[model samples]
Target: MTDAATRLATLAEEALGAPLPLRIRAWDRSETGPPGTPVLILRNRRALRRMLWKPGELGLARAWVAGDLEIEGDLYEALDQLAGLLWERDDEPAAGRPARLVTAWKAARDPRVRHAVRDLVALAGPGLPPAPPREEAGSTRGPLHTLRRDKQAISHHYDVGNDFYELVLGPSMVYSCAYWDRPDAALEDAQHAKLDLVCRKLALEPGQRLLDVGCGWGSMVLHAARAYGVRAVGITLSEEQASYARKRIADAGLTEKVEIRVQDYREIDDGPYDAISSIGMAEHVGSVRYAEYTGILHRLLAPGGRLLNHQIARRPEPDEEAYHVDEFIDRYVFPDGELAPVGRTVSQLEEAGFEVRDVEAIREHYALTLRRWVANLERSWPEAVRLTSPGRARVWRLYMAACALSFERNRIGVNQILAVRTPEGGASGLPLRTRDWRG
Candidate 1:
């Protein structure tokens, strides 16, 4: 190996306690690590210089997105290995202050270390290339939960082209956590089951009216209208979603039974609906506005009417700050999105005068759902790339995979909370036995 390759290898060993599972090939054709392993090719010196300049996951992600670094072979495995190395490093006990100072003094005095540091500094100096434009980045304007800003955030994510979403989400077009009755069930079947599950939990009657807040692609609205014989009204902030959902309702011949509106929940004055369903949209409602959201749902539903809220929640961790994965998501994916704990969600519902009936944790089901989405995206990679930029595709791939891992590890949770608006001195209107809804 050349001196540069050798130095990198040594740095890897020192930092990660072992050489990387993949081989690293520098710009000069200098190679290190095992030949048969997966290859991580650095296109130019800027790649290494970027790593030294920012020195963490962000730097690596920037390099990969900017086309300075390329990974050959399994992309998932490469990310897994990278995460494992970071986990191991964090698990190591920290040295005392004096010991760290002594080590730093020794490193600063080493002639080879000095020279290497100077070379990296010069490479990453003012002449470094500017960061590529993040066309997919979300908006950072206005207050968190205002009607205007919420629309902007929702549009930033869901308006990325219906064709692109179709490529990733499959035919069912369900964007929420699916209910997989069996391990080998198909994606469409699982999504159907999830929609039926929500309808069942709400116990819709033949002529009752149902409102679906933040409905994506009108899946729930169509399902309720077709299967449960209910008049459904679905609302969303994305004009693209509203347009596509209307066309779908028209094609399904449910235009009279189902309605899609590009309206905000806060502005809805027509209410007294028999039932309401809010799925996968509460995360965008900041914790500060969670009470207001639940209050709105409570007011919209008729007395004794059921409200089913399905949302993703963050699991309680000892070091709360350490479990924050929203930094990357807020920048590249869902801007201003916040997840509250399940307990907090329940409390908000109760505070809004809704009696909480049931809270079902479907964490593993979301893991399965995300895994299927990643598989679908991989299968349609060519179409996906044609519809969107390569960097945008990579963002979805990495974000979805990481979320699946997070769900599998119990770092986060998805829950369906069943609540009811109870009249004064009245019962909850739910059946005494849970088996009544199972059928």
Candidate 2:
């Protein structure tokens, strides 16, 4: 084996408590191979030593960004291992009571840090009320617009600059997987197919009206209007997004068919649509009102109409540390957002009188998506930095990196659920074979 491989073998053995199992191939230091390879590939022992020494969060993060360290196999798994490396307990003595006192002292000095710490702590703490007000917005935004306020939290990170997003998310701004149910398809093709797949799952038809909840920049709206021949109404709380989506719809010459309102889903007046889709939006629906929130969608959809709820989900375990990081997302990237497990989601849907028809776990798909996004972000960082703040760049990196790790470790997941309401006073008479999407 080459010397670089030899050093990597040693580091892998130490980190994993076993020798490396697979053959290692060092690339041209450019991180430019498959879509989801390691962050970087080190060529020599010194570089590996340097990465091991400056072992703070940012340093290791930069090492990945700079293409100094690398991994193979699942990208998300690699990231989880890397994250664990940051907090690894080395030879340093564990301080007992003094550490607790120091932590208390630090918490007392900075309320912001204390809040952050508390959020993490609460995830692991005892059960609390279902719908506690997120601390980010204190009594100011009010209940009527609480959802809007949370939507703004999601918009903050996404609306930084269209160009930045374009670089990372690509032309579609899909924000979700491409539905690679079939092999040998390209990413763009898979994305378009996924959009079509959603439309088909909803069984959308020409002239049918559809409502898209939490439509980001209106990709699905435009797609449905153009491809499925459906009139689409999408609601978003982001001013920037609404404006852009409207312009895109107008430019597409489908102004009559597609309209996006800069309003909360609760305020959406054009209801009784034939179909409903909430892609990447359920995360923002606080757990306190999962039932009521879904009931609202059921009421909004016409009888027998389908509702597609796409969301990221947590595992069944009551993991508090996981919740802490999730709370961080609410505070920073997605204000007022809450992630629910599959059981909670299905229960809420069932309570809303909707029969769950299908559910698919796109965990690895999301990992691949985030991995590509991070890579695109890194590739375009130089140009991207000129357009946005350094903090913004760091936030994107950390958020996407953490997300990649989340999916890689199976700590989180993405689910696309198709549900339909019964037509009569009770269950719908529709055939189970009606679930087929041949059309």
Candidate 3:
């Protein structure tokens, strides 16, 4: 009889109609495929059962999260090899050749596929459906983007422990994209540069009031207060963030200059802030509430005040309506989060009564940032697993690595859109000369 790894490889190639890219190491200590390749560790039959039950990206994600599927070599290479099989870049329905999705859907009717599934069932053995790991979030509990639901969504992602975050995010504790002078800049320095870049774009002046929406751990508020002499209000839904930020503020003796609130952006009553920064936050706003989110910030800012909106955007789909959230991201990393095209983001800001000034696409910066983050997590792997769970650590590692690849390939991008609420004279506060935001 053939070993499990050989059987697995044969079965997978036959069912998917493609070669298995990664080397296979089965539970029986049997291995197959060439040397020096990434070995995919399939710990047990349950891993196969996961694939059989869900039969797509979610299935793979489940097995990975459950510590059943693991890679023993270069993770990026493994992901790169699997990308074409998993994430199809083409949005058009027309596939000149039969796509994996079409092939899977026709599996029942096709005799070859039916035989493959029967073999897969025998290989997977008998088992009830495995429960998802405790780290995974359930499906959206309430109406999307409601005040309560938003809080829950925010908490799900952000409440994963400040210690763990500090390890992953480093001393900066800034979760957004960093402005890298070069590809190899220090993480802290790059993060500082990014904060300063935002302040310059907003033209922060002495005693100006700034509002930072979705501020993570008060990095922006503290930086602005210390460096630019701005009084700032930073708000987030995560209590852990608020607590961590408040302590940082007090320690820095900037308590008087900055306020950290565990409050939703919608609940902010006092407004007319001189400037606003919503970095890496609007993706959580959901497309349905995007207009409202932009309107809120526009209303909150005084006339001639600048708004720096930093967000991640996906490639525009041909049908637009054909776009959907990645199942792994929605379920594991960012619950109920959504991304829009950069053009759509600019249009919505313009519609909300803001004159969009500059749109900078710093796609490569994010790829670098994510790689640094992955390095941080991998460096502190044991501590990270101790602080969070092994499952959560794995989630971070996979998502960050995958996202880094996404950024590098331009499958998605991060943009900084600087807009302003122009007064009646239509005079924007920006200088006559062009200011380079990327430094």
Candidate 4:
């Protein structure tokens, strides 16, 4: 009789028509596949059953989250090897579900794959489908990106314990990508440089007003107030973030210079701010509401004021309607987040009545930043698992690792877009050599 590990690999290959890139270690202490590759550890039969029920990325994610599947050896290498088969190998504009269904339907009719499926079902054993991990996001409460639904989404992602965040973010506490002068610069320096660069681009001056939308833990607001002498207001939906930011402001004795509000961007009516910085926040605005979001920022800024929008961008699909959010990301990471191409975002900003000045791609910087975050989490592994659950920690590890690879491969990117609310005469208030501000 075939050993469990060998049988699992053989059956999967029979269905895939290609060899798996890694080894597998089964719960029965059986091992198979390439000798030097990372081991995909099946800790129990439940992992197979989870995959059987869901049958794709979500099932794989659920198994990992439930502590039933484990990765041994180099995690990044393992993911990179599997990328061809599982993620980030799109050959064309998203074919959408109909095309995928056609492919699946054809595969289901293949006799070899049918035989493999039967064996896999028997291997998974007899049981009800496993419950999804508790950490997964539940169904939306209202219309997508509605104020109520958005709030819930933000809370789900950001309200994970502050201490846990502190462990990952370190002392600087900035959630977005750090600006790096050298590839090996410390995380703190990189983060400070990022904040300073944003300040310089906006030309912050003493007594000027600055608004930071979707401010996580008030890092940008505090940096602006402390370094540029600007009065800053930071808003977020997470009560935990608001409370933490308020305390940081008070501790830094910046209460007079900075204010942290538990508020929504849509609810904010105070306008004519000298500058606005929306960092890593626009993704949650959703494609449906992004124009409204950009327009709101445009309306809030005073004439000649600048807005620095830092955001992640996905490759634009030829058929935009075919672009589907990643199921693992939607359920386990950012619930309502939607990444748009940088071109689309710039167009939307222009439509919202801003004169776009410059667009800088910092794709590599984010890859570096995520690598640092993963290192931080790993170094504090015992505490991180204690602070959150093992499942939540696993979710972060997997998502961050996968994202780092995505940025490296240019499958995704991050950009800092600088635009101005030009006045009647149309001056952007920018220097002729604006590139110097990036440093």
Candidate 5:
């Protein structure tokens, strides 16, 4: 029989193109390997003992975090390969009948945090719609500063290396837009369709000035400027993202038409933009200040100007399990983010003095988008592991899995709302579509 060392060597030779560079140390009695093809497996003494005694995925992940399991070379790819051969790929699993019924019951009530009682209510009682928003007490604090800080929460995941993101995100790196209407569309096509859809909804015209709030790496801004011939200004709180966006704009020779600002939306004094787009940013506005947040956009737009508030929202009425799972995302992924249902969103816009013209739900589309992202991330895990620590990799893995689950289960949704600000009490007669335009 081959010894453990020889077996590992043989496995390494077959799996990886190069020989393994294994290092064993008494510091925690850990073994680690360098980056390369296949996986560079690392095992600590504790993990080794555990594997010998009993084996489980939880044990494996824990060992990896404990510095027991290490991998080198394309961590994302390694993970992907392992997932194809190992982990269950189901989007959502079917619980037993009783458990499913219980979960179904819990998901029927819209509550702060669904308790067992709520589940009973969902199972036994009539469904209640989501509670309405209260009057704005308004804050004495600066909303712009709050906006910037809120942006940080949204951009946190974006800092997880563009390469890792690229593995999961579509080729266009358009983080916000994905067309869910077409089930068979490619990521690039879906994203482009989303962008075009937004442009159409906003009624983008050549020479129209556009503002993108919480613009991620300037994807929307760049696309609008180039495709629609609009002068675009994008604001983001992420310094790294702002720098990257600026470089991208420069590279595309769009410096003349596109401006990337590393500042908070509230701090922006220059506006009266022809249109506004805030994709995936409204969730961070907090339910408390929804009116004010939208009001600010309305005030900044030109008369008869339109605004697209693209965000994740909950259903007007939701069950207990959905509430529980959504709260989990708030604590782990979004931190300060809160999602209001579409009814509340529209009502808030109306309260802010804007007329809601349309509402679109891309929930199913986002579910598909997230699944693709997961597949991409899995495929790139090997590279991801090599570039990042096990803890980081696990965090992303868990986050992606949770997000995918959230979309699949309808605990969350994305809304693209087109709202128009009436001109001076509905007096202006601006043409909806202009034929004569200057580029």
Candidate 6:
């Protein structure tokens, strides 16, 4: 191995206190670590420079997204092993901050270190380049959660391309946590089951009005209108999604029964619907606006109407009051997205004057859902890259796989909460027993 490559291998071994779990192949074709392990190939010196300068997940992510780094084996498994080692290393006590700073200063003076540091500093900060080229970084402006900003955020994410989403989401086009009847159920079937589950929970009957807030491509609305005979109105911020949904609804011959609008949830005024379903959209609603969101839903639903709020929640420690995702996600994936604890979400629901009837945690289902998406993306990688930029494709691949790992580890959760706006002495309009919607 070259001297630089050898030094890097030695540094990694010392940092982890063991031989690296994965093999490393430097740009010069020099290899290190076990032969059979997943291989992390550094394409150039810039890869190592990026990692050393930023020194965390963001750095590694930038290297991967920039095509400076590539993994030759199971990415998820590699990440798992790396994460375990990092966690274990973090748990061990380290030198004080001042001592670490002094060490860093001393190391910064080395020729290789100085070169990387100068290059990184010359770029004017640690942040990655603005996205759509090397990354899919979100650049939304305006006040957070405002109608305009929400539209910007939603459009940036969902407007990537319909064909691209189809490759990832499959034929069902359901983007939320699917309800898997069996551990081996197909993704399409599971997605259908999840849609029907929401409809059954709403107890839709003929001629009832259903408002699907933050609906993506009208999966739930289409299912409800076609199967449950409900008049459904699905709203989304992405014009692309609304256009595609309208086409799908018309093609399905449900044009008369379903309406797809390019409108924000906060902009919908004609409401008092019998039921509302907010699937996979609450994460985008910052915690600061949780109350406003729940209140808006409450105002829209008629008395005795049901609201099915499906969202991703954070699983915090018993005494912890906060949960946060990585900075990379905030920039590249779901910008301004916030995952509130289930307790806080339920409290918001109750405080909005709705009776919280049920809160079902289905985190494992989400893990399955994300894995299926990652598999689909991998299978259609070439087509996905054709439909969107390479950077955007990489964003989805990395974020979804990482999120699947997080869900499996109980670091996050997906919950379907059923609430009802009950009038004085009125029933919740739900059956006492949960019906088998899959039937």
Please, what are the lDDT tens digits per residue for candidate 3 over residues 1-439? 3489999888777766767767999988899977788998989989988878886678888999999999899999888666655554543345332245324535567777778778878988988989998889977765799999989888999999999999999999999999998987899999999999999999998899999999999999999999989999999999999999999999999989999988888889899999999999999999989999999999999999999999999988888888789989999999999999999999999999999999989999999999999999999899999999999999999999999998998889999999999998988867776475421
lDDT, residue 22, candidate 3: 75
Q: Candidate 6: count the clashes.
A: 0
The 10-residue segment of model 6 with minimum total lDDT is 95-104
Checking candidate 6 for backbone clashes, the offending pairs are none
Q: Candidate 4, after superposition: displacement of residue 227 in Å?
A: 0.7
Model 6, residue 25: C-alpha shift (Å): 1.3
lDDT of 4 by residue, 102-121 (tens): 23324778898788888888
> What does candidate 5 score on TM?
0.65
lDDT digits (tens) for residues 1-439 of candidate 2: 3244444444444334433333444432322323444434554333333333343443344444434444456555555444443432221234221122123323344554455344433322344222221222233256622665666565665667776777778888777766775544466777787788889888889999999998888999999999889999988877777887888899899999998887777776567989999999878777666776798899899888889898899866455445433433544466566777888899889988998888888888877777777888888888776777554565677678788777876778899998987688766534567657744
Please, what is the whole-model Cα lDDT of each candidate in the order they appear? 0.80, 0.66, 0.89, 0.90, 0.63, 0.80
Q: Which should have the higher TM-score, number 2 or number 4?
A: 4
> Which structure is stronger by TM-score: 3 or 5?
3
Q: In model 3, where is the ten-residue run with the lowest total lDDT? A: 90-99
Q: How accurate is candidate 4 locally (lDDT)?
A: 0.90
Give the CA lDDT, 0 to 100, for residue 215 in model 5: 86
My TM-score estimates for the predictions, one after another, are: 0.87, 0.69, 0.96, 0.96, 0.65, 0.87
* Model 5 lDDT per residue over 1-439, tens place: 2133344333333332344433222223333344344453534335444322222233344445445556555544454333322222222345211112222223436342234333323322243332211111122344432655565565655565666666667567776648855777788888888888888788788899999998887889988999989999998777777888898899999999999988776678897999999998787778657777887898899888889899888755435234322322343346566777788888999888888777888787887777677677677778877765555565556556555556666757888888888786674333454222111
RMSD of each: 4.4, 11.1, 2.3, 3.0, 13.9, 4.9
Error of 6 at 181 (Å): 1.6
Where model 2 places Cα greater than 4 Å from the true spot, the runs are: 1-78, 85-148, 181-185, 319-327, 425-431
Candidate 4: 10-residue stretch with minimal lDDT: 96-105
